[model samples]
Structure formats: structure tokens, C-alpha cells
Target chain A: MTLAAASHGFLSPTGVEIAFVLVGIATLGAALQTVTSRQLVHAALWLVVALGGVAVEYLLLTAEFIAWVQVLIYVGSVVVLLLFGLMLTKAPIGPSPDADSGNRWAALTVAGASAAALVWVVVDAFRATWIDLDGTVQGSAEVSGRSLFRFWVLPFEALSVLLLAALVGAIVLSRRGGDAKGAAETSAPAAGEERH
Target chain B: MHLAYPAVLAVLLFCTGLYGVLARRNAILVLMSVELMLNAVNLNLVAFDVWLRDALHGGQALTLFTIAVAAAEIGIGLAIVLLVYRNRGSSDIDRLRDLAERPAGPAGAAGSREAQPDTGAEATA
Candidate 1:
């Protein structure tokens, strides 16, 4: 099928737009819940929902490769890592009273202002623009890979190194607590033995 | 087909994340908020890339790199938060005012000095 023909067929008033709006709403709601939920676990789960909705939005935009990556990296790994952190740190599983600060009203105001400004600017700038989805498949894995490997290879490799460094840093930080605990344990036994 | 839909969505998501970062007390939740903001950025990148119809797919490519960076950030951020929880038994940012300057005294000097070694060790570790 030709690009223009495909877009013309799909772009007609149909369920796609409705689906996009619905998914967008769901994503926004999930994100709001993720941030506001008091229970740490619930918040994490809600984050998964929000992230998943983003993936769905990607799919709707015909970026299948990016969507799956979103599912795998974000919904698959990051949230799991977050859960691990929550568990290791013993964050409360239930609603936490201290989850909110007293500066919510102020925060809301700032957020509102920034959001309004960003929206206004983006809308004004792109008011007449429309994505020519009828053109080349920009979202395909092949196209994305070519771009990444050809033009963005340096940053891509750098990102890998950054991930490795982060892995090491996380291990070091978590291990420090373990080492301290071990030291306290061993020292307590020695002191007790000496007293005896 | 209008760019406004996704643009508005990204704006809303970004602001919600900003609110979460400023208002949330839990360190982990704050990190989650950061992720939300990053996602908003990704949405904008992809939307613009498509709208511009660039042959290189630079937006999608950058989005991939962003996802990687975000992952790395969360990993390190969570590690620091865990370390804080271990030392203080609480993750309350407000309670972390020990860095603030105290009245000049031997006690204050000793207290600040004592707090430095553990953090240094953790960093080196």
C-alpha cells in the first residue's frame, strides 16, 4: 500500500483518534495516581500502569519498536528495580502519613504555571503542523537502528557505559550498608566475648 | 493528526511530575516523579520527530538513549536513597538538615566531622 493512501485511509474519522484520546486520558490518570498514591507499592504499580499507557501510546503512533522497548525497559526493569529498592529500604507497604509535604498548594501553583507555559508554547509553535505519517516508516526498528548506529553511535555507547557505572554505583552503595551491619555484628560478638 | 493532542498530554504529564517532585515526601516517590517528567520529554521528542518527518528518525533514536539514561539515573538515585534510609532510619528530606551550618562550637564541629566519614566511605565503596 502507498504511504499517502494508507494515511488517508487511516486518518479518516474513526476509532484511532478516539483510542488515542482514551489512552492519553488513561495515561494521565495513571501518572497522577502514581505520584499521589500514599502506599509505596501502590505507587509503583500505578507507575507501571502509567508507563504501560505510554507504551500503548507509542504503539498507537505506529512506533512499535519504541513501544516494546518502553515495555521491556520501563515496565519490565525500572519498576522492578524500584520495587526492589522499596523493599530493601523497607518503605511502608501501606498508606504513609508522611508521603505528602505541606507545600502541595505551592507546588501545584508552580506546576500549573509551567504546564500552561509549555502547552501554550508548543501549541503555538506547532499549531499548523501535521505528522506526515504517509512518508517513510520512521518508527521501524531498521530505521531507528540505522539512525542510532550511524549518527548516534557515540552517545549510544556512552549510554551503555553510563548504565554500567550506575550498576556498579548501586552495588557499592547498597553494599556499604551491608558492610556496616556486618562490622557491627562482628564487633558486638567480640566485645561480648571480651566481657565474659 | 493535530500535534496539539500529544503536546498537551506531555505538558500535563510534565506538570504532574513537577508537583510530585515538589510535594512528595518519600524519596522513591520523588524518583518516580522524575521518571514521569522524562517520559513527557520522550513524548515530545517522538511527536516532533514524526511531525517533522525527518529521514534520520533522530527523535526516536534520542528517545532510546533517553530511556537508557533514565534507567541509569533511577539505579543510582535509588541507591543513594537506600543509603540515606540505612543511616537515618527515615527518608524524610526535611529531617536531613544536618548539612545546615550549626552554631560555632566544639560540639557542632565534632558532630559534622563525625557525619562525614560514613558518607565518604560509602562514596568510595
Candidate 2:
């Protein structure tokens, strides 16, 4: 289908519009939950919702490769690992006492200002240029993958090393009580002590 | 030529996620908020990619890399959050004040008793 037909054609236009609205609503809902949820796991789940919404948006734009990557990398791996970390660390399962703090107002003010600035910059930059949205991008994995491994190869390799180091660091940090003595010292007394 | 829909959605998602990052104290929640913001950016990228499909096709390629990098980031970010929780006895951002650059765990001279022990907190507190 031509770009104009996909956008202005009767069935496609309505279909696209409905998809856009639904995706937008879902994204907004998830974003709200990601911030306001008291439990860490709940927030992570919301992140999944938000990320999934993005994937759906990509699908709407006919970028199937990018959409699947969104699912595989973000929703599947990232959020799951995040939940694993929360469980392993034993973050408070119940409602956290101090979900919001005294500095909330300050943080909000700064975030608001930054967002405003970003929005202003983007709007000003694109004020005159009109974007044609009923277009298709040849985002097949072959094209994107080749480019990433070619001209972007150095940065990609650097990122790999960085990730490897981070993985090793995580293993070492989390496995601190590796020896029996440290393990015993770490947990033996905690079984008996109770604090209010 | 109407890009208003995607733009509005992107702005809304970003603003809401920003609010969450600012309002939430749990490290995991904060990380989730970051994910929200990233998704908003992804939407913008794909939208622009569709708009400029006949051009360089840079946005879609960048989005692919972004997804990969985001996954790796979450992996390490979650590990750090877990490590902080283990050392601080709590994951609340308020309680993690000692993480201002130097590692503030038992490796320092904070002493085990005074140092935060997440297991201890979980067992007793």
C-alpha cells in the first residue's frame, strides 16, 4: 500500500488511528504506574507494560524487526533481570514506608524544567518541517545489523567489554559471602535478632 | 504530514515517567521509570524513522542499538540496585545516602554492625 493510501484510505486510516490511541493510552498508564507504585516489583511490571506499548507502536509503524527486538531485549530480558535483582536483594515486599520524600518537590521542579526545555527545543527545531508519517522504513534486521556491526563496530565492542566487566562486578558483589566464615558471620546472628 | 499524535504521546509518556522517577524512592521503581522514558524516546525514533524512510534510515538503526544497550543497561543497573540493597539494609533512596561515589559497604571501615545488612533487616526488621 502506498503511504497516502495507508494513511488516508478509509479502513487503514481509522485502523491506524485507533491503534495509535490505544497504544498511547497503554503507554501513559504504564508510565504512571512505573512511577507511583509503592512496590519495586510493581514498578518493574509497569515498565514491561510501557516497553510493550512501545513495541506495539513500532508494529503500527510497520517496523516489525524493531518491534520484536523491543520485546526480546526490553520486555523479555531487561525487566525479568530487574525482577530477579529485586527478589535477590530482598527489597521490601510490602509497601515501602518512604515512597516519597522531602525532596520530592525539588526533584519535581527540576524534572519539570528539564522536560520543558527539551520539549521547547524539539518543537522549535521542528516547527517548520512537516513530517510525512504514512511512510515505511526498510528496517529489516539485515540492514540494521550490518550497519551496527560495521561502522559502529568499535563502539559495539567497547559496549561488550563494559557489559562483561559489569557482569563480573555483579557476580563478585552479590557473592560476597563466598567463604563459609563470611557466610556464617553474615547470617547466623541475624536469625535471632529482632528489631522494631 | 500530521506528526502530532506521536509527538503528543511521546511527550505524555516522557512527562509521566519523569514524574515517577522523581516521586518514587525504591531503586527498582526508579529504574522502571527510566525504562518508561526510554520507551518514549523509542517511539519518537520509530516515528521519525517512518517519516524519513527514504532518507538515511539512521533512526531505525539507532533504535535497534538502543534496544540492545537498554537491555544491557538494565542488567547492570539491577545488579547495582541489588548490591546497594544488600549493603544498605534498605532499597529506599533516602536510606542509601552513603553511595555518593565511594563504595559504602563492609569494604569500608563502617563496621558490620553499623553497616547496612539487608539480610539482617529482612530477618529482624
Q: Report lDDT per candidate.
A: 0.82, 0.70
Off by over 4 Å in 2: A1-14, A112-136, A149-151, A177-196, B54-56, B99-125
Considering only N, C-alpha and C atoms within 3 Å, which residue pairs clash in candidate 1?
Answer: none
TM-score of every prediction relative to native? 0.83, 0.73
In CAPRI terms, where does candidate 2 land? acceptable
Model 1: lDDT equals 0.82
DockQ of model 1, rounded to 2 decimals: 0.52
Taking the tens digit of each residue's C-alpha lDDT, what string does model 2 give over B25-45? 777777777777787888888
Model 1 regions more than 4 Å off: A1-14, A177-196, B101-125
Name the TM-score of candidate 2. 0.73
Instruction: Tell me the tens digit of each residue's lDDT in model 1 across B28-94.
Output: 8899999999999998888888877777788899899899899989989988997777666777776
Deviation (Å) of B26 in candidate 1: 0.5
Model 2 per-residue lDDT at A103: 75
Considering just the first chain, candidate 2 attains a TM-score of 0.71
